[model samples]
Target chain A: MINIILNNRQESIDVDSMTVQELLNHKNFTFKLLVVKINGKLIKRDSYDEAVIRDGDEVTVLHLVSGG
Target chain B: MSEMIDTKIRQHLSRFRVGIAGCGGLGSNCGVALARVGIGELVIVDFDVVEKSNLNRQYYFLKQVGLPKTEALQHNISLIDPTVRITSHNTTIKSDNVAELFGGCDVVVEAFDRADQKVMLIESMSLLLPDTPLISGSGMAGWGNNHLIRCEQYGNLYVCGDQQTEVSPDVPPLAPRVGIVASMQANFVMEILMRKKV
Candidate 1:
């Protein structure tokens, strides 16, 4: 069980995979322009598969889309 | 004859070449504000067309509907200051060419509406142009309280707005709140220009 703030909102999730990429897949985030930050540290795309999502981590999943 | 200006703020702005990513509500309003002050140059990017729906908050006329956003906004801003130079890009901004597109700008305005585009702009701009400042908006949605709109800066990335509201079908972007955040972004740009030596 891990608790993380998703886009400023607090949430807790229990998932099988513990990597950052796995969490994004579990949450079904398919945004093309997503910048993931874990505990204030930016996670580059290359590190997603290896970066671990620990318990009580603060994550900012910024999904860039087209509105303006 | 040259018109006499009262303050040096106007002179400071003349040295800036601001890059605007979106020409919608935020970009259009901010451009108008900068144009009023006669910013030296602007690079306005938008791959959208003016619809009847955009007239509520965006700076476009009813007759301008169906025209491209870049063209419409350029025409509108030109009315405020004919001397201010504006370059319009009729394409979307992606990671690959974003830097090259706005390379010569002094500051970049990230007025995108989508979360993905905003994130892309922030990341790409920060990575490519580390020293250049970027102003963006978040959570300026619905007809909520205008007082909630404020700005917070992280390094050179300054984000303005309520920082909570997300646009939805029920909670739409209105003129008042959008105007507040847009003006805040524009004001920050001018303030940065004034404080920093060009």
Candidate 2:
């Protein structure tokens, strides 16, 4: 088990290493306009599957909602 | 005989140009407010036409129901202040032309309604115009959550909205709520423009 800070909140995941896509799915972050940043580095949409997040990584998933 | 005293502030405001990404609810209303506030130049882009339904929240008149949004908005702003330069592009904003369109502006306003489009604008702008500030709106639908609407800053991106209210059948985009967010976006643009160079 590894603990990571997700959006200013710490959460314990059952994996030592997981891709950004995996972390998003695990957290159920299905927002279409989410901007993901791992350790202050932005992860592009295409690179989500390749970007890996390890223990103690700081991740911020900003949900940009749909409206006007 | 120059009959002017506070020409410094007006001249300062007339030196900057702002770009509007989508001339829908937020864009239309924000554009009007900026124009009224004496923004020097406005670069607006929109491929959609004004419909009767847009009259609810958008800043358009009944006579402009069939006109293109960019043209109609240009005319409205001209009526407000003909001296204000309005350069409008009546076309769809894609990633390829995003920089060419708004690269020169001091600030860009992302007023798109769709989440995908918002993402596209933010991604393209962040890559193309890294230094330019982007003011966007999200979740300004329906009403009664006036207190929830707020502005958040992330790097150069400033988003003004509740950040949660997704538009659905139950939560439609009304005037007051949309206006609140639009005013916030315009206010941000004003603040960015009014800042001293450092």
Candidate 3:
């Protein structure tokens, strides 16, 4: 079981050994132009697949498109 | 007394200062719109000069081709409103002087053409002037159909542009799209000064 906190809400998911991309997919976030902050560090888009999500990790996703 | 207070508030709003970076497509239009609407003080910053290529989108006359963008924009703003307090900085906003460039502004508008410069300006503003609101644009190029723009807030920062999956480095932005986004930026600044949440 992993604790995924998104935008300040905590969620319990039954997934083990999942990559960042897989975690985003599980949460139904399909936008590719998003900036991912995991534990206060920005994860680059190229490293999304290589980064692993552990238990009790906090992830904040921000959409950076469309604004003046 | 209420009438006096209204007069004072109007004076403050008229004296509200805005800083515009880049002075290209988006910057030119934003400055013009702000000046036309009676924004009292404007600080225009840009390091580039006018070329034949910029004449398509940039608001400068053919006779002003060799002039710095900041100077040309100041001239244009003067033509629109001679009483407006307009200052032009013919230098780039770097890490060292960004704070100084944006010092007394109520809001900072990022209208740079380059994505890298835009990112750098945002980071610098976050560090230097955290309380000042920053409005930036992205994805205004390559046949975008959505003319009505949406603004997304990030703390004190607001960004406007299309939500494209990938941004090509070489894609040239057109006038109509950049104008749409720049107007939104100016409107956002107005709303902020008017105490309205964008």
Candidate 4:
């Protein structure tokens, strides 16, 4: 069981192993232009592939869409 | 020649002082527009030089290439309105000098191209001038639909860019998009000075 926190919401997901991209896909989030903070450290877009989701890891995804 | 002026609007605009960081694409357009419309005072800051590439979207001429942005922008505003009191800062806004750079400014405009600088400026404003309005720009890129441009206000800070739902890495930053965002920023400043809802 992996505990995922998104925008301050906590949820437990049953997945064997997952990457950031896969998690976003599962959430139906298609936008790639986003800032991912895992435990308060920003994960670069390119490093999304190397980041492995772990159990009880907190992740915050902030969408940077157009807003003035 | 004494002319009749809206006493309320004149009184409102007279006391406002605007600070514009990054005098490049968005800053140039916004600064010029503000000065042209008789804003009380404008403090323009930029640590860049005019390059040939900037002519596309910046409110400068080809002859201004190689000139310091602050100096060139000061001249540009002078041509627009000689009476507009303009202050130019030829250095970049940093954590060390942000307070002095933007001090006494009623509104701060974040128009830098670098994302880190934008974040830094916002944080600095939050710390140094929490009560002042910070109008920021983001997602003014690509050649998408013009109607997508919108303005949002968050407390004392306002952002003029695309909504958080439509952003892609493929979106290339361009001048026209930035211009639209800059105009929105100017409008927000005007509204704030006019005591209108953002």
Binned by DockQ into CAPRI classes (incorrect, acceptable, medium, high), candidate 2 is medium
- The numbered model that scores best in lDDT is 2
* Model 3 error, position B131 (Å): 0.6
Residue-wise C-alpha lDDT for candidate 4, range B65-169, written one tens digit per residue: 999998999899999878778888899689889899888888989888766676667667766787888898876767667887777665566778774423256
Instruction: Give the DockQ (2 decimals) of all models.
Output: 0.26, 0.58, 0.22, 0.17
Note each model's CA RMSD in angstroms: 5.3, 3.4, 5.5, 7.0
Candidate 3, residue B121: Cα displacement in angstroms equals 1.0
Clashes of each: 8, 0, 9, 9
Q: Considering TM-score, which of the candidate structures 2 and 4 is the better prediction for this target?
A: 2
What DockQ does predicted model 4 obtain? 0.17
Stretches of candidate 2 off by over 4 Å are A1-18, A38-41, A53-59, B1-8
Chain A TM-score per model, please list them. Answer: 0.85, 0.91, 0.85, 0.85
The runs of at least 3 residues in candidate 4 whose Cα sits more than 4 Å from the true structure, single-residue gaps closed, are: A1-68, B1-11, B163-171, B196-198
Best by TM-score: 2
Residue-wise lDDT of candidate 4 within A1-68, one digit each (tens)? 78777655788888966888888888888864565656645566787788877877777664454421
lDDT of 3 by residue, A1-68 (tens): 88877655787889775787887888788864565656645566788899887887777665544322
Residue B70's lDDT in candidate 3: 91
Worst 10 residues of 1 chain B by lDDT: B1-10
Interface RMSD of each: 4.0, 1.9, 5.1, 6.3
> Residue A2 error for model 1, in Å?
18
- Contacts from the true interface found in each model, as a fraction, amount to 0.39, 0.74, 0.16, 0.27
Candidate 2 has a DockQ of 0.58
Error of 1 at B182 (Å): 0.5
> Highest DockQ: which candidate?
2
